[model samples]
Structures are given as structure tokens and as C-alpha cells.
Target: MLVHHLYSGGKDSSLAAWVLTRLGYEVELVTVTFGLLDNWRFARETAKRLGFKHRVLKLPVEVLESAVETAIRDGHPNNAIQFIHEKALEALASMPDVVRVSDGTRRDDRVPFLDLPKARSLEDRFNVAYIRPLLGLGYKTIRELTERLFIVEIRESEELQKADYEVELRHLLRERGIDPLEIFPKRHYQSRVLGWKSL
Candidate 1:
């Protein structure tokens, strides 16, 4: 069966796509963007390196607006990012061709983690399977696997323009005369898949 994996060009999502491929599923990497930036192209490049079909889905700009508003209200990006993640999943699940939707959300993820209740709701509403290939793996194990299978470039989120939701959120904040650094933690590092480590 075919599975669409929400990819951010990061190690976790790349590793999740790899795992889904090995499990005999035809995996396609899909990146969600609000059209504010071309960051999704970075994810498309990474998908090419991993040999998975890739595409970009443009969500309504209101999605980013809502997320940014939430971040501004909460004084942190956590809840806002989680809100965007769930919305992205919902969009993917509702696609006519999508029977199964997956993401890189792991046991250690806090911001974009989908709990059992939310996952069940998604599945029940869309009549599609919601899969998390890395759900059972923690950060350490995911890192080990990614290290062995791919070459990754890691840097502070502001420094790396990968396809994750944060980039557009930051841009929107800046456009509104708000500094993203105030909402997003400065210590956060984002990864972009460079290529596969030659086996």
C-alpha cells in the first residue's frame, strides 16, 4: 500500500520515510507549506536523495495566521506548532488518494506529538490509517539509526531553512513586526538531510 509521510527534510522525518520504505510500503514524502517561503524545495531535494517520491502541499495562509496568533497569545511556539502539525495531518488525511498518513513524530517529540485520542479521531474521521513509524523510538535510538543511514546537517532553527512549519511561522511573525526569537526558543536545532551515507 502507499503511505504519505509528512516530511520536514529533517533526520526524524527522513528516517521515518526510510523505515516505511523498508516495511514494503510505497512511501511518498509530502511537505506542507503556506507559500510564504520555498523551504519545501529543501525537503524535495532530501527526498530525492532518499529515493522517495516527493511533493508539496500548500495549505491556506490562514493556517499560518492562526498558528502565529496562537504563539503570540501563548508566548511560546509549542502549542502553535502542535496546532499546525495537527492541521497538516488533517489536510493530508482528507486527500482522496491518501489512505494512510504518517509523520516523524517519535516518543520524544513534545510539540508535534499526536496522542492516542487525537490519532484515533483522525483515523475515525478520515477512514484512513494514521501511522507513526518512529512512535516507539526515542531520541537516542532515532539519532543512532539516522547516523548510520544518512548524512544530516544540523543547526539552530533560525539558521536552517528546512521545510518544517517553523520557517513560515517565523517569517509571518517578522512580517507582523514581531521577532520570532521571542516566540521560538533559540536553543532549538533543526536538521536537513544532506544525503544517504554510502553503505
Candidate 2:
């Protein structure tokens, strides 16, 4: 199946991209730029280094209000970040060969969303399955993978350190014991397990 890996330019997403490519899947790396403001140069650079086709989509923060509302109604503390992925996936649905949208979700993230009522098989949603190559690993494991793979220069800009409103909100949620990052997708569903690392 044609797959597109969601590239966040972070250690987790980069490691997931590497895993997908090495497994012999025809995977493309896609990053959704928030407000056209943050140009994920890291994701782009990683895609270049790994030689994977990279795609980007710009999303307005306001465009995600409905998603935010839904998430909030569901008591999701990191509603904004979930809204970001909702917008990102919506944008991806418009593209071609999007049979699967791969993510960097790990074991912990599999809990909430995977068990939520909204959790449908990927094929049921985007005509694509959402794959998570690093679902078996944790943040530490992802970091170890990056070191082992010799991943270089994948840090975000200082501007993003304090500028990403969603990430900041996620931090707040983290403090409240929500841990928003845990809701990110994963690759632990019923499927032929395959390793897709490229570098």
C-alpha cells in the first residue's frame, strides 16, 4: 500500500520515517505547517537526508475550532494538539496516494485514542490506514533509535520553543496529568508488522 509518514521533524517522527522506509514500503514524508508560520525545516531536512518524498500542508489555527470543540467535549486536555492532527489529516485527505498516514506514536499513546469510540480503523477514515512504526518504543527508545541511526540536526527553531501555542498547551496538559502526546497514533493494530527504517 502507498504510505505517507507524518513528519514532525522531531525525534519521534523522524525515527518513524526512517523505520517506514527501511521496511521497503513506498512511503512519503508529509509535514503540516501550522499557520504557514512554522516552516518545519527539520522535517524537510530529514526527508532530504533520507531521500523520501516530502510533502507539506499549511493549516490555520482557527480552522481547527470544531475539532477543538469536539476534543474538549470529550474532555481531552490537549484539545489543541488533537485539533492540529485533525487539521493535518484533513489536509492529507486531499492529496494523492494517501492510503496510509504513518505516525510516530509509541506504546503509551495507544491507550486513549485506540480505545476511544472514535477510534476506527484507518481505512474507515482516510481511505488510508494510520501506521505507527515506533508504537513498541517509548520516548527514550525513540531517542536511542535516533542516536543509533546517527540522525543529525533535527532540532526545532528557538522561535518554536516558546511560539508553538499547541505545544505549550500540551505542556500545561502534561502538568495536569493529561500527557497529550500519549494520544498520538501508533502501529499496533492488526496488520503485517514491517520495519521501514531508511537510514
Show where candidate 1 strays beyond 4 Å.
Answer: none
- Quote the positional error of residue 196 for candidate 2 in Å: 15
Q: What is the lDDT for 86 in model 1?
A: 93
**lDDT tens digits by residue: candidate 2, 1-199:** 5677766655666677768878878878777655434545555765676667877766664554444445445665355555566556656764675667777667776322243333353446666666768777876876666766643442233223322224434444455576454532222111111122455
The per-candidate count of clashes, in order, stands at 0, 10
Native-referenced Cα lDDT, model 2: 0.56
Measured against the true structure, the TM-scores of the candidates, in listed sequence, are 0.98, 0.64
Residue 183, candidate 1: Cα error in Å is 0.7
Candidate 2 stretches greater than 4 Å from native: 64-77, 94-96, 110-117, 152-199
Model 2 residue 58 distance off true place after TM-score fit, in angstroms:
2.4
> What digit string (tens of lDDT, one per residue) describes model 1 on residues 100-135?
999999987887998899999999999999999999
Clashing residue pairs for model 2: 18-197, 19-196, 19-197, 20-196, 21-196, 22-196, 22-197, 23-195, 23-196, 99-128
Per-prediction CA RMSD (Å):
0.7, 8.3
lDDT of each: 0.93, 0.56
> Given candidate 1, what's the lDDT at residue 2?
99
